[model samples]
Target chain A: MAVTTLEPTTGTVPTRRGPDSPRRRKVRRQAWLFMGLAHVLTLKQYLVGAFFAVLELLFLISLPQIVTNLANLVTLGEPALDVPVKERPNSLFMLVDGVITIALILLFVAVYYVSVRSALTQERAWPPDEPTPPRRRLRDTITGAAFPVLGLAPTVVLLIFFVVVPLVFSTLVAFTNYSAPDHIPPAKTIDWVGLDTFVYMFGGSATWTAALARVFTWTIVWALAATVTCYFGGMLIAVLLTENRFRVTPLLRAIFILPYAIPSVVSLLYWQNALNGAFGTVNRTLLALGLIDSPIPWLSDAWLAKFTVVTINLWAGFPYFMLLIIGTMTSISKDVLEAAEVDGASKVSRFRHIVLPLVMYQTAPLMILSFAHNLNNFGAIFFLTGGDPAVADTTTTGAGGTDIMVSWIYKLTITLLKYNQASVLAVMIFVVLAPFAIFQFQRTKSYREGEL
Target chain B: MSDVVVRRINTAAVAIIFTVVAIAVLWPVVHLVSAAFTPGRSMANMPVIPFSNGFTTEHFEYLFTQTDYLRWFGNTLIVATATCLGTLLFASLGAYVFSRFRFTFKRPLLMGMLILQVFPSFVGMVAIYVLLYRIGGLDTLWGLVLFYIAGNMPFMIWLVKSYVDGIPRSLDEAARIDGASNLRTYAQIIVPVARPILTFLAVTSFTAPWMDFILPKLILRSPERQTLALGLFSFVTDKNNFFTTFAAGGLLVAVPFVIFFIATQKSLIASLAGGAVKE
Candidate 1:
């Protein structure tokens, strides 16, 4: 790891010297001078560095002037303009500040340049006679290995700025009195207020509490109902399509996947119209068959609205589940099922014992992810009902009986402009889902281990 | 001989059950199309008879005449096309680098991308809105496209990277031996090999902007810039023209995508399934 030297004017000489040698002192002096000039050449490299240095200098020289101006502006108002603009800070003082700022900036630039160039120069100066050391090779390997990190810098920076910073800012907002039409920054003059929003949500304020409870209940019910109904319904379709006796299995499979391929919004709007009580196709067909006397209030009544939304979600979601299950089912070894069949297992028994367990085991992780997705299902509920059957209460903002936590948060931010509360809700959602995320991470690790 | 007969019976029963289920599954879509064309007492009073008393192209006419339906369609096409092109370019390049290069922080970077999918993008809504507003992207199609790309990048990068990873490194090595640089190797070798996944990505990416409503609603303030999904919302909400015209518009939106999906279904399914298994 010794530094290599270029040919010297005196001779082909090694620059390695004892610590107290005069040659060492002369070499260090030359290195410092080279570093200083290199720093001057790379001014742009230290622009950000220079900016801070200048800011510090300005603060020191201009603090008194700024305070005096602020006092005049506050006290004299219009009269302050009649006074002559104060003389610029003393010239000698300004010069000193500027020089000091420049010096610091130049120093920073010099240090950065010398370090980089020396590293590069030393790397190039390795003697032709000696082999590169193992330790050096290992260091190079480690450094080169960080290429992916360099590649991911933009995405990581974006995630921090857009996702992490906003999340943290919103979480902080939740603990403050930041509310509609007057969201002030929490500066030194302002005091922090904590947990008032949460208290209001859960306290004896009947409107908020009732809306909270209702939305929470519906969110859980919707998630479970949508996930389970889709799971079973999809499994059934998958089983039917894959059955050896089915003549038109491929066509059936294609048709089943149609709902999934169409985007969820399209499906929701299409179904919303199809389910309209007054002129919808479903009611017409039902009445044509004499199934009911009057059209059902599918989107107007609370329970019916919730049920319709869930059913639409199930319709939209199941096809993907069906696809996943079918894939899983096909991957099962045919010989295992053939063996069971030869043993005289009934069709139901074979499905229950052989098909179901295998598919379930393989698709368990996907099913869990689906559950999380359903819990945060926003598009279906928003486009279909817009969380309709609006609760009669006004104080609860714009949330309806069908609102999930996500939709409720939307209502808070967009419709009501209760951003502080929305932030609180967003944080709460993250908190609620954190455990599942951790579980998923752990599962991925173990899965990797198992594969190894 | 008796067991053979029983097996035949079971087969017949399974076929019958499948047929019944298929009918149930398909009935609604058939009803939707038929209702779209049915002319008599709206959809609510249609008879079981196959032929209606009258048939008309009146709904389609109304959709074009009375609403900004065509304009919305055009807007959506532009947005979806731009989004697809942008996403494919950036995501493919990023995915290629990650797949081909031995770089530091690769593992952490991949994990970070995966973790992003767990949190919905709406969590950053306020910040994005303010940032876009300050930067003058608010109320513009470009703003919508930016959000769309950002929202979809994590999944797209993972997908493209997985497909790229499946391609043999020897291809790159061969190209390099032929004196092609890294960029040339990617363009001349890797991309051509990854065409199937690229097509899948394109279709999915294009379809996303066409289907999206929330982001456009948030960002695009002017009616002139409203996309098809938002435009369809107007038709659905308008009490007078909600029924027939809404059906017509829905049919219009669904048909193109249905055809596209049918054409590319095999490749799409293969790419997705392959990615999942490899991941």
Candidate 2:
């Protein structure tokens, strides 16, 4: 779409000055300089020129400092005893400053590009006999450009500082020694330790490597199981409701969607309590029914807690998929199914060949997204079990049997202040998840059609 | 006769599965209501049946009288409302530009937003925490609101852009021809036409912060500033026997939330389906 919208003009301009004229070449070269068009610019045009000039001046001024910041980022900081304490080397500060500087430079380059493009446009539009007045030129550019500039500026700036900057800072944290009680800022300085954290986590120690292996494997399993179970569970419920002609179908559908309707945090927490080993309602009712003499360790056991969270996730997750599949099912034309049935396909085969393929085509991307979401489904495990009923490696690694990569990252950074390790895991999650994101994007209509 | 027999069997099978699944799904909800109304301080004493112990408003009463329930509700309301309004403002603005204008990096920027959503925001939470500390946003409600607004930007922009893309340019062009400024045309024309999707965005964004736990837990550490999720979570975890009270508080939020969700489920799903795929 942008290609269509931003195509360069190929039409010839009727120039009073000849094609090889010196004047035309001069104007073309002048378009690259700030205030170069001042001879032809009116008062309003001068103001526009002044605005871009100020931006250019700011960009020039910040260039050296940005370069210095980049240099300091590589060195982090040296504990210069000659400097005051406040001016002393803080690696965190340097890294943050470096990231900010890069964001600023990107912004400045965008502005520079816009200004130059506007200047060229102004030059091209100049008349052969009588040029457009400066006031009119100013109005034209403002109308053409100002709307997007004003509209996008706030969101763009916020994303740069908040989302992009922090991501860069975290990515950089993996290469540092910013852990607490030794390398914390303002008292102790952190130094760059390239790939050491990664090496340590993967093969550094027996406990850590084992913990990483367990959590990573479980993360993949949880993502796969959660996505598949929810998808099929919803499909079953949706098919059952749709295929059956029951008087109570609407009521059942309404009741089934309760988990989806209620906030997930509330539901997960309530389930945690209901499954309590000693005092939970599930155990209490089971005891009253004489099913078991002792309470079951629902959230206390390592393996059961994993099963409990996944099953409970089924209850919490299925309704959304049910609704989505039902939506997709409604779009399946009756003619297609009827044709399949008439071709001697039994009911099951008709569903398998016709309805299943149709529905899968529409909902598969969502299923993949669901897998990605489950990979970091912190609240599902955190609130339910707090990754508790700790396994052998939990004490050393701060990871319980149910802890996924994101939750483990939380435990490391928030509870243990292991910034270096947390960031390494964060980077690993990014690596593992990026392929799924790219795959989804490639399947999107925008990419396939080469239009947005 | 065989057809009738097969239909009967099918109906019987459907009924059996429905009963089992329905109980499995609805038991927790039923138990939550029971726990909230049962006359007890401890969940251990309560029976399984609803109203078996006789109904009492004591837990709800205790929630209001003893805990910071009202304060937490107010804080949550404030934060959710602000996040909704803020998301609406920035996302709609950014979306309008994306839909209407042809600019450099437009495609790359959109792609960047998609990629950003892939990287979990919590991974950078340490940097976020430190950033907030530097800005004096730690332990403040506004800081949480700002963070939520920033987090909602990428997806909401794409969603709202899909909606805005459908509006006929003629309407805005007509307004522009009548000497309306771009802002005026957007405010007076484009926004009203895009109301359905915007309303969907507003409702979803509002609901997000209401039950969000982790971000509020990390950012807001004060007793009085806790959101509903944080406050209710503390009820069971703290050194108190307030399981019933936790139930009471949970329902207070859940009941209204469920009602709102059900009321808007049709449009929400419709808009999501509309916005997700670009045909």
Candidate 3:
């Protein structure tokens, strides 16, 4: 404990006699390391914290230098890895990955600096102020951080490694020319073609530009159609089942929730089979009913496929709204309804005027959320249509009739192996959907108030 | 007399509408069960009543004996259990910190978490893949759990923190006065009171991976390491597919979930509403 707080006792040998000692003078100088902050811990805590900080610094140092050199390669065109390839590997991914790793390391250093700086603050008062010493004990001055650091260690580690690093890496990949053919690593070196991919995606290639316009339009349409149909359909079913004076309404509600209760993957596959172009259960039933002279192309023909996926999406999704509506309805105040009744409102009018708005009011945030959710509803699109009923114009671009932004990204990445394009598309998704998400969450007012 | 007649007609109309809607909603579930029990029933010749033919358990037998389903089931169980346990532990601890402690970075940290959750995590799939591959965790269940538990931490923290805040600090004070440390106080006093929320978290965490397809499909490579969703999906993906066997596998996957849903239906709906549509 270097900055030990010496009690200046008047009767005790003038503790000032030792004030001129070198160690004492050094302590006095270091005591004001934290000028304004209160020293909140004891000397034991300071040692424990210092020990942990050193351990953390060592851990960070071990992993960062290798990535830093790789990042340097990105900023300057050169190879950093040990492997001597016959052909040099692309450095774009290396660059992105390296920058992410270094940034994470730098972030840790900042945190450590803050921790130590705060720990070194001199105590405003300690030991009831026995004629306060010029310097404090090293052990006691290192206060306030030990227990909190120990508690927060696991969560912070996870955030840094799993969340922060990956986000940065993904963001960096968006800036390079990472698409197919020439940019792949281990075969050919990737050079930074800053904003070229963005240019092509936005306004360069006629095919690319046309595809984005078309797919983006369809994405908006699908989100709106899917969300509205499900919401209204759910509201109708919930209203009927709950309001109707039927003994079996409870049983019917349970049965209706089956679609929601089943695994979405299974339900989606089942719908796909039921809508298959050639021998679907839906076609067989239609033929049996003579509703059509010939089987309709439910999952083929670009237009029909759009309708089919949306309808099937509604089929899989309505139960969620139904469940939500029912929960809200059950909790609705009967007094309001009775008051409306006294105002001469009939049943239908009561539903139209009183009940609908209340449910909508309560569920509006969720409805907007579902719209945003539908924007990236990969399961419904992927399992049901696989983004099929391909459009001839955008086939090379990989945007199909049923493709939402998310499934389109999946196609670009996995099937086409154009990760740079996929990362760009992912960023596009965030750009488009994140604001709406934040807006809807804000509209809820609960999150804003620190309610949860 | 006229009012009575109108009321009767209204009830009848509602009954008819509800019954039709229920039947339509139940069609897929009914078909799934029917297909599972009928041996080799393809989509081409599926009867209106899928179970019109005699029932057979051959599809299930094929699943167990001819496929690595038991292994998939084991893998899913391990992953789900680990995820639930890991999420419960991490979320509770993080929530406690936010609820009880005041620090400079608390608000910003919470806000960052909320913003982070707004973007889907799959956007970072390639990045995560590279990280995991370098760290030797790419193809393992533990890797999947680490991803999921970390992914789920923010929302769960927000949820459990709100619940913790509702718990009075006086209880903690009382425990501290009784010679208890913070850890002891949290363990004995607060944790017991937060059981409902914790159980809600466990159920959701367990069920999420059970229904999920994207991450499992992206990460796992070998057939032996497949989850139920991946294994069942393989049935229809290949040439000369077995739709019946796929249905059988799907049915098996859904059975436990359906039972759990029915048992906890009320709590599930309440939690869903509270978590999603907060007021």
Candidate 4:
């Protein structure tokens, strides 16, 4: 070990040294490098050293197991006829365990780094003017940096083992052949098929390419239409209500909020039941009213099903923006609107020039966020259409006429057991949504001034 | 001015349009509520107008007696309550630490969580299912509760952290001076003062599981372990024609939920719009 010594004490005259003294400067420099042995290791140093050693020992002991898991993750468990059934290695288990092991190892490495850096920080601040006791130093460290570590430990652990591990495992599934009937574990093993799913999805086969193009374009269209329709439709109601002209405004407001107040699953399912083509209430009612030649195939025809989903979505969706816009509009000062009105501006002009701009300025971010929300609105499509009115190609491609990427992902995973394809779609979704996430992140309040 | 004439036309037009839209909006709601009390099991036979089909309680009776509706409701309540409590506890601890402590990678970690929150939780369906199977979380309410708590952490933690940051550090310092430990100060001072925001967090988190169907449907395999969403959905599937019963079960959940939502909507709306406006 590298050693350093302090200057010898003067016999008569005391040394006139500032903070740049050799001993002080050397200690600071060595602390940062996490090097050099002083004359004695304080109790705090011993504790910190012991902590690092324990982590190191744990990592070393687990290193072999980790390697085996990672190897299994790649190979996905080879076939062993000689092995008993109970001892058979399963590919899916290996995959999940491998992911968990990798996550744990990453956590271990991170903690190891943090402990070392913390040790250095403590060492740099060592030996206070009063020569703090080692026990006091350790306690000070605990109350300082270690406080956050202890406080957040449980949350971090839960997030990792539950959230992060599963996400990583699924993302990894995108690159492998982990589908049903062929590569399922215990019966057979999975092998990595990098870029094959991507190629197959994008342009490898005509049917898949057609499905991808159709679903992607529809998803974009649906998101845009849903956002625009809901935003403007809600704005209309909010603007009208803000007129405050009616004595029954409160009652109407209550009536309007019923859609928003009810749980979405219940609403969607109820609408699905109500709109059933043959015996549903809507069709029967229309027939009774003499409003149709015959029963309308509301959810049966592909084009009509798409329209029905969007219109119904408009019904379920508009209330949120109504509440939101009303809140924003109420906050606007009365002066701006009055000023526009006094200038001989018509009601239309006043709305176009003043109220619209203010509301948009305030709620544009939310609109963008809502657009992102609509892209993956699984229940809106799932509960209503159930991606019904399957097109000719739906058998070959998992997508239905009304299926958004998210709902299609659901169908792929649950009904079809097409895990690999589902993961690929999930990755595509991540790629598509990443930009929106970054934009939203930048606009978040805490992000702007998180320094505090 | 000619503008006056136009304004009158516009107001009349707005009134007519509002009336039409209002009728359209109330139509389905009335139909749903009336369907719950309608005499028939078939949805096609039920009249469109409210109470036109004649009121009956057979559906509600069937829901309570013949089906596992109560068990499903209980499971939902247990799972939702556990998720809410767990999210509150962990999120508060995380928020407190983040707000008060100066640690490395805090900013990046927060940013990462913000990004991750955008990805829908169902994207990891396969892995979560397999992971649950390994841990025996399948068909268990606690497994569903565990997933929800973990999923809720990132967003709820950020929300509460922002709220906690507004709280003056002086409160913590004063508690410290009074010989209170850090955890004690957090529990005593920070939490009580942060109650309003915590209430907002509680409402959002609690309401999520009630609306969700896919997660519960995936994790819960047993008839006894089904949630309200799963149970109610089962009533009107392709295989079954229990539309009236489904409506009845749905109404039970909606009535109380709507009341609760309307009551807390003021704070909920503020909390929601607060994020956008903060920019």
Candidate 5:
């Protein structure tokens, strides 16, 4: 990270005389006069420039008074309107006063511009023939500083406005009692109730705690079940598809990707319908084949609901895993696989000993990410069941039997209009998921660098 | 001879396993599309002989006539296209700078982008809602696109920048020596070379705004502004004839991406894996 500086071709100093000399002073004065004229010309180039310039000047002059008035309104909770009519300024009157003040400020700016131009003309400092000083270097560096800042400004502003600010606000809401009727108008103010929501959410009733525990347990179960199932499922598919001797490998790969190619919402919705409790094709076919006496409530019962969501997730996610694993499998050097073959290693042994480990090592971060994704999986659970099979007698608002943290957050925000509570849940979810995200990010960064 | 024959048998057996697994993966989807035109209210009510009930386009027709399917499709296309274009422009410029420049605070800037990616998209849901409400973007397509880009920019920058980094620096130097300005160099030399990864990014980024339900549902409160994903949700939740039409709509949504994947599967697979490794 050493800074590389290029050498200047000539001595930094020009042959011009000192600024105190008559020649230098004349050049400096002329430069000032030219700059003043340039400023006037620039203003003339745009029709509204003069107007805006005056407006800008007025804004600058009256900014302090404006700030004071704003502070008064904010701190005093709106101006008292019941004061004596003769003594009191009404809010409308105050607004008018502000406008007049701004107008006077604009007039002042018009006058100041004339004076500043005359001053700059009298004391100009320019002309490149003069030797540049260390101060010029400092000026150059200061101006150059804006380059990187300008380059990064959009990203930084976006992050602050969209990411950082939201995160802080959400975290703040988590400490307050911000839910339900308390969230309604005027009475709807988000009251600061420190840890009350968390305590109520995690404690209070056994049912509340039990419901949370169930969701958390299922969240972990879904993440694990989905990740592991997809991982092995993908690995197996990749291995089969990539085998050199396998004819029609392209056709098989295409078939394998059908699930991945389809949008998750479409597939998930279709599957939800297909797995309907009574007349779903699966149930109908199963019963017709005499597999079971009763149609299983695939989405109504809690366990069945959880199982179905995972199964749907598996279908939706495994193709992605297969695609990724196949890609990683191809990148595995041929020599190593050939070496395994030369050693007379059986196909299973070669896969178990060589291929699986290599692919896992390469794809470990993605697997971690997939796990985190499943934990916060709102789409599958949402489109499929909308977190249905409502938990019995649960006091929580919209806590479905199958809701993950995300769907629950959705329930709070969109369904119940409990922004404060939703914000809290969102922050809590971030806190839980942040570490895994960090790990994935770091691993990916290093992996990228390694590839480079 | 004996060993070779055994290995051949094993390979055939492996291929057979794959064929079966492929069928298993495809069966549900195939059944779904078939059931979409099953010509009955429920599966139980349908004739046992699949197409014997007579093939029908009723589900698709129902989707068009009953729901706001066309509106949803148009909204999704507009948002997805705008998002793709916006993402490509901003992410490419940002990634180019990150990849090429040696500047102060570069590490911190890169790190910030990475960290931003990790914050769940939903965390910003409240803040964005308020911000958009203030700015009058509520229930608007533009509001959805803005949030979509904001949610997606970090990952796209990281992905695209890494791909750009893999291109030889000499190519840039060569162009510069030929009197190409920085902008020209990027536009002429770098972008063309990086087309594969750019396609990957465009498709994936476009797919996000297209497939996303949560953001559109939260932002687009008006039924007319609903994207396909949100529009489909209406039918899925209808609890009646909507389910069959929902399947048809789902098929409609899936068709384009599936066709795209099939057409560009090779490049898509290559770039996806390349991006993962680069990541």
Candidate 6:
């Protein structure tokens, strides 16, 4: 992660000449003046800073003009208070575009600001050669900053345009009255309603509040169940396969991974059918075996549907952990286990004290990530049940028995066009899930190694 | 002698359990294969085991001839291929910069990328839909491709960056001293050494767009432009039947993916299991 090769400036020197020292600080203050600047910087470094400084000026000039134009249209071009929305025409897109452009310009300013600092530091670091012009120091700083600055520009641009812009747009959407009848743009005008939607969602109505509570509570429960079950289920299977006791280890591994290998949509769809209440192969098989009196309503009953989807999720998800844990398990040194054995540890104790901790430590971040993943796992809910057995009571909030927050958001936006409410749910998800992602990412081997 | 006897017994017991679990795991595959060849509308009579109702090529024939399956496959292939290549090109550069360089926002951006990884991009579907609608990208393949590339970038960059981090910096320094530029050193030295992780990212990025249902469902409104996931999904959802046809398509989807996954399963598991993440 070391990018630059430029030598440290005289700022790091311990002598009275150090940049932060009293006399040196006085000199550096004077150095900000045009006359003082010429003393500290070479002509070449001036050109680089001047070039970027001009670009920064351009950004500052252009961005506000766009914002000004949008502001003018919002104010001067507005229809009277009683005028219809169509007569008013929507200023939302123009406003959003202008604001985002300004943000991008500020980002540009920040990037160039750092670049200029390095250029100044470079020119200041060198020992004065007679006339105090060092072309070498100029070249070193330019080289130091050039590749990284230039290399990262494209990705940073992509991040802004795609990730940042969309994020800003979606977040802005949360506060606006952009829902069904009176809010959708172009045909209808949406104004910021502040916290009305959130208030309604949380404290306004008893039914709505209860539904929100129910969906969020179920989402947490589902995440825990999915993670815990898959973790141990995969562990059980992986441990069995790794004993050097199974003759068909390779075949067993392959078969177990099949669920993970198949495209999840395909498997989820098949299971949705296989476990069908009526003629599903699952019910058919069970009936033939005389295990059930009749077909179980696998995908319809409220509580049963949640269990059904979780079971199917386990089927599709376990192989991932199974594979991952088995990898961790096998890589455990035979010598370590034997050493534990020599210490008179039983199999269970050795596993408890040695094996499980080591593997858990390695896979802990992934386990956290997996839980977050299931939290937003849309397909598991969408395809398996489509939030079937919809709780009639929760219609005010548009959730169902099996509806996780993500799926609930999908329902609100796609099925109901309740975009405003959906945006709130989406924001809620990000708020809730971002911390887990941050925590898990900070725990990755790369992050732990301080690579970032 | 007692220990040997005990070990032998353990092996036998584990072997029997493994067989049962293996069969249970493979049950879906067996049933899918059977349904694909079963000459019927729904899987009403097709037995749980293969060949219960005998096999035929009719469902496969129907999937190819009577529907837009081929077109969906073609669209998926194009989207997946473009998404894979685009992800590699962009993600590798981002990863290399992240692995090899320090900049102003390096730490924040790294953490930001991590945060972005879990930010359900599906949340932006409405915004994306409206944006693309204005841009005339709705119902277009490139629109889906653009989103997939952007969606895959953060995770791919993080994964590849971790892999690149494990490589020694001495190689970079040596190359620099040998008169190579920073880009050259990364391109020639770091990338080659990072091939296994790169391959893993490529396979995953390729399959990600292939399996994605939501984005395609939201974007591609027309039947002709539907992806495999969308097309196959519509069979059961939009219709009351076509179980065999759905099975045929699903069976076809699993074949190449399962084989490829099994082949490269080690690299995948290694990278993901903190093996490739280690310094």
True contacts kept of each: 0.20, 0.51, 0.39, 0.57, 0.37, 0.49
Q: Model 1 chain B, poorest ten-residue lDDT window?
A: B41-50
Error of 3 at A211 (Å): 1.5
Candidate 6 on A341-418: residue-level lDDT in tens?
A: 999999889888998998888776677778998898898888888777778775666788899988888888888888
- Cα miss at A297, model 1 (Å)? 2.9
Q: List the residue pairs that clash in candidate 5.
A: A184-A188
Candidate 1 lDDT over residue span A1-452, tens digit each: 01122212212434443453442343345435544222223222233224334644565576676555444322222212333435322221222233233434444453344334443333234443445411233233223322233334444444544454445555655665455554422211112357878887786467777877778778878888998989888887778777773556767677777787666666787677677788776777778889999999898788889988877777787777777777777667889999999999988899999988887777777677777888888888888888887668634577886888888888877777676678777877777777666655555532365411
DockQ (model 2, Cα): 0.50
lDDT of 4 by residue, B1-279 (tens): 597897788778987988998998888888889989999886876876779868799988898899999998898899889999999998998888877765666766777678878877777888888899998889899989988998888888888888888888777877877877667878999999999888878877887898898899889998889998898889888999888898899999999987876776666566656655654
For model 6, state the Cα shift of residue A352 in Å. Answer: 3.4
Tens digits of per-residue lDDT for model 5, B1-279: 698998889887886787677666776777767767867655455443345566788988887887789999999999999989878877886777677765444576677677768777775565556556655888999988877777777888888887887888888878767866556766898789888778777887888877788888778888788899877777656565566677678787888888988887777676657756766
TM-score of each: 0.76, 0.91, 0.88, 0.91, 0.79, 0.88
lDDT of each: 0.64, 0.80, 0.72, 0.80, 0.67, 0.76
Task: Select the stronger candidate by DockQ from 2 and 6.
Answer: 2
lDDT of 3 by residue, B29-134 (tens): 8888898888555776567667987789998899899988899989999999999999998888777766776443555677667667666677676577777776
Model 1: pairs clashing at backbone N, Cα or C within 3 Å: A145-B104, A146-B104, A147-B103, A147-B104, A148-B103, A148-B104, A149-B104
The predicted structure with the larger TM-score, 1 or 4, is 4
Provide DockQ values for all models, in the order shown.
0.26, 0.50, 0.46, 0.48, 0.39, 0.47
- Give every collision pair in model 6: none
Order candidates by lDDT, high to low. 2, 4, 6, 3, 5, 1
Q: List runs of model 3 lying over 4 Å from the truth.
A: A1-46, A56-67, A70-73, A76-93, A117-147, A339-350, A440-452, B238-240, B276-279
User: Each candidate's interface RMSD, rounded to one decimal?
Assistant: 9.1, 3.4, 6.7, 7.4, 6.5, 3.5
What tens digits encode model 5's per-residue C-alpha lDDT throughout A1-452?
Answer: 10111112211323334546554345345424432333233222122224335555666676898776554322322333365544443332232233334434444443344333332322233444545311223233222322333444465555555566556656655665545664432222334567776777677656656766777777788788888988878877777777664567787778878888888888887777778887676777678789989998999898888888877777777788888878888888999989989999987899889988888787887888888877877887888898888878444666888888788778777668666667666776777787875775667653456421
Most accurate candidate by DockQ: 2
For candidate 5, the per-residue lDDT at A128 reads: 40
CAPRI-style grade of the A/B interface in model 2: medium
